[model samples]
Target: MKARAGGPDHRPPLISEHDRDAAVHRLQEAYAEGRLSHEELDESLHQVLTAKTHSDLASFPEENESTIAAVSGRIRRRGVWRVPRILKVESALGRVHLDLSRAVIEHPVVDIEVHLGTGNARITVPRDAIVDVEDLRTGWKDPLYKTRRRSRPGGPMIRISGTMGLGRLKIRHARR
Candidate 1:
């Protein structure tokens, strides 16, 4: 289903005990890897448990047309590049929306990082790609986000880092 700006896309917040467990497991892994300090992990864990709606859990940027336009343009240009053997996405706070409907990439892998303070997130991946997901939290639902990985060719790898706020991320793939 297409998500309109400011329109209620009722896809039933994809939350479940399994989802929660996966998120927590990822956080613990980060701690073990020393990617996150103990203090940071504790704070994120608390926020995740207390969060209710998607907005209560993910991070989003202010809706600025110019900013969106600029970022969109950058993404478009970069997307046109010879698909890197690997790609990476990293963010600290605010929502990230990616539309790959018109994207052309010959790359074999992509990595994403999302950082949050308190909020919810939704991410959509192509319908034919292989994906692996991981999350690191600070409080409650540490990384309060929902992820969908569709099957597609090209074998892309994505890694997301989330912080505080509510938002979504989508990746569309070109048809062969």
Candidate 2:
């Protein structure tokens, strides 16, 4: 057991991956129950994901949500745009391209929920951003995401979920 920073205890309880996961699940439940705002959830998620020990986890951010949908036209978002805490994107037949390399993302954690019918979706994340696509579901092809052996510490976490029907998801990290 390692002592937490600034704590009085000489030997603190050891933290495990299961513990971290439980914390994250509880935070999500809190958000779903309206006890926490989107921003608050983001901040809390970041802390939970990045915390080295249990004592370091605390605080949360505000609330904001955004959506992008298209029936047949291409859905594209690039340049210096603001990213909301919860972003919902839906497209029936158009390809979706989201470039977050140069976007303004204030939250520590961003959830991108995508629903596609036909065309593929491409997402370019920031160089140091941590991306998780475990919850993403595909109808045909698997997502084209090469996981890095190790990511930099304290990068904002991005979670991509939802369904991609008859289309694939391609994720790449920014070059710069």
Candidate 3:
């Protein structure tokens, strides 16, 4: 059954971390150029990260709450796999991939811990889910590339955190 016009879209159009990150990046640049205040930057970043639709993001905008573990080898997950509530992945000298485009999600929030040691880790998420990367500690240069996806108010959330040492962390959206 179709809902009424102007009403809430039960399943809002999906947004990706990449889209959100780009928006945030722009705001950051603006702040750096003295177009915005520190407070504005923080508030804008929050708005961008929480934006529901692209339009929501456009207005001054923009947009897991886990577990898997991988260590010392190349690990990949994809294609109809089951994503546990808590997944942790640790690579002492290898690679880890946590792809959720085709995975089974049975929770409103998922938590993931990605710890790398002289290795690499890549996380691929669905456009519909949000990607939250916070408190990532790294003493050495651990390059991290990601597409920021925000969790809808009541939708699925993916929380990611960890430490990377001489490793690279990449988080992006899967190709549709």
Candidate 4:
């Protein structure tokens, strides 16, 4: 059925009795067609009746946010598969170690924004990539600096921005 735009009818119910009835009907049809065993049908019907919301009905029993985070972190660590892509790294405390050696890209660029309450930070880039350092600090030493090197042609662009607190940011090209 088509729903009118910006209307209450367009909004889906968080939990609807009609949806529960439909699920029961489907279970009955499956049992009649011998597609679902008696035990399986009973278990499915119990689940459908016990699920109070659409989210509860749609999700697996073991699914959760931590599982998703672990999967995402593993994928992100595979840097070689992420060349020529923009990466954002943030840490409230502790140092962030990034391995530029494994990052295989013609020009691997990074744009970093750091907000450190304390401690130090270091960002390493491949030797073939160009490093651009920008520090916005009111304190001395700047707590961030890039080693002086002749600008090489066709190098990746690396931009780093540092915020408040004491921390040293070292940028160097990764050795092959």
Clashes of each: 48, 3, 29, 2
lDDT of 4: 0.54
lDDT by residue for model 4 (52-135), tens? 877555221221111111211221233563443334454444555555656655323445454554445565676666666654
How accurate locally is residue 162 in candidate 2, as Cα lDDT from 0 to 100? 95
For 1-176, candidate 3 gives per-residue lDDT tens digits of 89876678565676788888899889977665434546767887888888978877844421121444455668888789877766777667888777898898766567777777877677887766777777677657644655544433544577877788886677777665
Per-model lDDT? 0.44, 0.86, 0.70, 0.54
Candidate 2 overall lDDT versus native: 0.86
Clashing pairs in 4: 126-174, 127-174
- Backbone clash tally for model 4? 2
- Rank the models by lDDT, top first: 2, 3, 4, 1
Across 48-73, the per-residue lDDT of candidate 1 in tens digits comes to 55666444442212211111222221
Off by over 4 Å in 4: 1-85, 106-109, 135-141, 144-152
lDDT per residue as tens, model 2, 1-176: 87777677755566688988888888987676445768778888988888777797654434578899999989999999998988999999989999999999876788999999999899999988999999999999999998766678867789999999998999999988
User: Looking at candidate 2, what is the lDDT of residue 166?
Assistant: 95
The number of the candidate with the highest TM-score is 2
In terms of lDDT, the poorest run of 10 residues in model 1 is 60-69
- Can you give the lDDT of residue 18 in candidate 4? 89
Instruction: Quote the positional error of residue 111 for candidate 3 in Å.
Output: 0.6
- Cα deviation at 74, candidate 3, in Å, is 0.7
